[model samples]
Target: MKSYTIEEINAILKGELIGHTTEKIVGPEELEKAQANHITFIGSSTYAKLWAKSKASAAIVNETLSVEPGDDRALIKVKNADLAMAKILELYNPPKPHFDIDIHPTAVIHASASIGKGCIVGANCYVGKDVVLEKEVVLYPNVCVFDETIIGEATVVWSGTVIRERCIIGSNCIFHTNVSIGADGFGYRPSDDGRGLTKIPQIGNVVIGHYVEIGANSCVDRAKFSATIIGDGCKIDNLVQIAHNSVMGRSCIMAGHSGLAGSVTLGDGVIIGGSASIKDHTTIHSGATVGAGSGVMNNVAAGQTVLGYPAQEAREMLKQWVAMRRLAKK
Candidate 1:
């Protein structure tokens, strides 16, 4: 286990230290579960007020919060308590799963495939014909890279991931277990004979940008014509579904179970909350936030916050909710 003195932690966070400076912090823990040797964080006023009763020996507190250290404890005041806690957690993070630099004997690599220097292909991995894995790429067990796919430098793809043909994955991207990239989009039409449904041929690929992290079991469907693009620094949570031809701009976030329908366009910094669903062809402009469980049925203006079913502006939704509650009481 790693240990840091209060002075050392304060120096690392570049925070203002108050009270005892010699206490040893063994690790970080939740505010409610912290012990004398554990450090916790206070990001909100409520947490700050609870610090007096917490057993933690040290705490990283938000600079705006009015808090003081308890007897024999210490406080490190930083600009952002959450960010400071992230840094501290990095200090004690365990090592990732180990894979050797060489491909495992159980793996299958096609003759035309290019495995880059320092790449690790784990057991049962399949690299298809004409595939290219850039330098330092790591594929965990049972990963399937389809024909002509290109994974960029330092990308880590975990077990059970399937990258379909001709997809492009960017450098430093992380795709967790069971992630499916470039699956055929859901498209069908009535047959000319009026006897059955006809399936639309999806020919396009998925293009992911650098630093994007897709959580476990998320699916990015292949486009019908061109590429389904995910911009740089986007973070997609577990079980999210991004439909075909959707274009997401830089730094956008989709929480767990959120879904975007076909041809949806999200501008930079858009946030889709958990379980929210956007209608097909809807455009959410930059900095707009869709509230959790909202069903967005129309375009959202830039920087707007929308909530509720058939989601509208947050203020209007709240006003309607209040009015309905009052009527119900009567």
Candidate 2:
């Protein structure tokens, strides 16, 4: 029940307040559920219309909003209310420090491993032989860091994450729950007797760069010989599958369920929508946007927006659909 006066909140956000000064605010929440001590925000005029009925004690409203504040609630006006609210929320509820100065008793760190200073290994977490976890790394419960794996400083790995052998993850990265890095790639050869498949040895590992955020259940497969690399600031959504030897450039955004096949290369700032699948060895140039449900079979040029199977330009795909409809009517 931590509380801050409205004046303090205004100072925290550097925002100008338009209402009562002595009101106390605690945490931030949605307008519908925010109690007397909670502050909320309304970004658009559509939500501004509902301000009269909101239970929030205070609101961060954009300058353009014309809604009259209720007698019971206070309004703080700012240039970008949403951004201002985000800042306010950060001040009110700063992220809790996860890594303590000492490792938990249940954590298993091999005697041969080298764990750097300020690392927090949570309950049931395993740090294998020769593993290197740099300073300020936080591993949640049930995390497994395999042999020779190196996690850079200030990285936080959530529960159930498995960083396989020889993987190299960079600093300030966040991996959500169930993330699997450096897993064996889906590679196999026909057996000698023509009866079964033989697994190809995935001798390489995964390299994730600084500030990368991989969502829950996402997997980055290990390569056959080279690294499966994800560059700095890349954001991969949940359930995405990045295959062996795939190289994703900096600041790439991959939505949920997108699958990148082996050896595929995505240039910087590429945007892949949900459920998109790129063919093996394909190259998507910088700033390309692949629409949702696209099945990309060929290369996409830089700054292009592609859609549909064997993805074409979005407008072109729509035109082809129109032509197909007319032909079907014939």
Candidate 3:
């Protein structure tokens, strides 16, 4: 366990000390799990009460909470205890090194491809013809970058991620394991014989903007002509399906298991809860929050919060529900 004195921790975190600054802390643990010489945190008064009985050497506490120091424990007050904990973790956590930059002997790089400096291409990875990978890109084992794909600087693609032909990923993006970008959209047309399905060729690619995070096992499908675009800072959770021609605005959060059909547009700062579905050609404006399990059919305006199947305004849904119950009682 890494140890730091209370005074040392205060200086490192720039936190205010409420008790003895000479105490030594060995590591961090949850309040319930903390042992002697460990520092813990209480984000709320309920946890503060629990912390009073803890055997921890020190506790990070919110400023508004009243803490009576026990003989064995001291309090370090901060504006936000959780944020302080995050900062401390960031400071003390060891850095993860990028894999050494070398193409494995088993990997295939086309002669026409361009790989920039400090890029690591792992075993069985494929860099297709005309592909361009910028500086500091790391591809874990068995990644496949298809033809003409463009990956920008400082991108880290975990193992088994497949970038289909012509996909364009911007700088500082992270693709977790098993992510598939620029795959064919779920588009099909009825056959002339009316007996079979005709696959529509997805000729376009997906454009992923800077600082985007695509979670593991998620898929972003390619468009027919235009691109499916995920804007800068958008965070897409695992198992998400972004269909053809969909446009997600900056900083939108699309939670796990959510799906957007073709041509859907989400404005900046939209928050989509888990398992939500946005139908084709729908639009959701800025700051709107779509609750979990929602099926959004129509458009949602800025700052609106909607819920339920064929999602309606949250407050209106509650009011209607209450009225229905009252009538049922009658």
RMSD value for candidate 2:
3.0
Model 2: per-residue Cα lDDT over 1-330, one tens digit each:
678887778787776677673457878888888777788898997888777777777989898888666665677888998789778877767676555536889899999999889888898999999999999899998999999999999999999999999999999999999999999999999999999999999999999999999999999999998899999999999999999999999999999999999999999999999999999999999999999999999999999999999899989999999999999999
Q: What residue pairs are clashing in model 3?
A: none
Query: In candidate 1, what are the lDDT values of residues 1-330, reduced to their tens digit?
Result: 789899988888999998994558899999999999999999998788788888899999988988989689999999999899899999989899876647999999999999999999999999999999999999999999999999999999999999999999999999999999999999999999999999999999999999999999999999998999999999999999999999999999999999999999999999999999999999999999999999999999999999999899999999999999999999
> Could you list the CA RMSD of all candidates, in the order they appear?
1.0, 3.0, 2.4
For candidate 3, write residues 1-330 as lDDT tens digits.
Answer: 567887788787777787673556777888888888788888997898887668787888898999876674678889999899997777567766545548888899999999999888998999999999999888888999999999999999998999999999999999999999998988899999999999998888899999999999999999988899999999999999999999999999999999999999999999999999999999999999999999999999999999988799999988987999999999
Q: What is the lDDT of residue 34 in candidate 2?
A: 74
Q: What is the lDDT of residue 254 in candidate 1?
A: 100
Candidate with the larger lDDT of 1 and 3: 1
Regarding lDDT, does 1 or 2 come out ahead?
Answer: 1
Report the CA-based lDDT of candidate 1 relative to the real structure: 0.96
Report the backbone clash tally of model 2: 0
Worst 10 residues of 1 by lDDT: 94-103
Question: What's model 1's lDDT at 63?
Answer: 89
Model 3 scores a C-alpha lDDT of 0.90
Candidate with top lDDT is 1
> What residue pairs clash in candidate 2, if any at all?
none
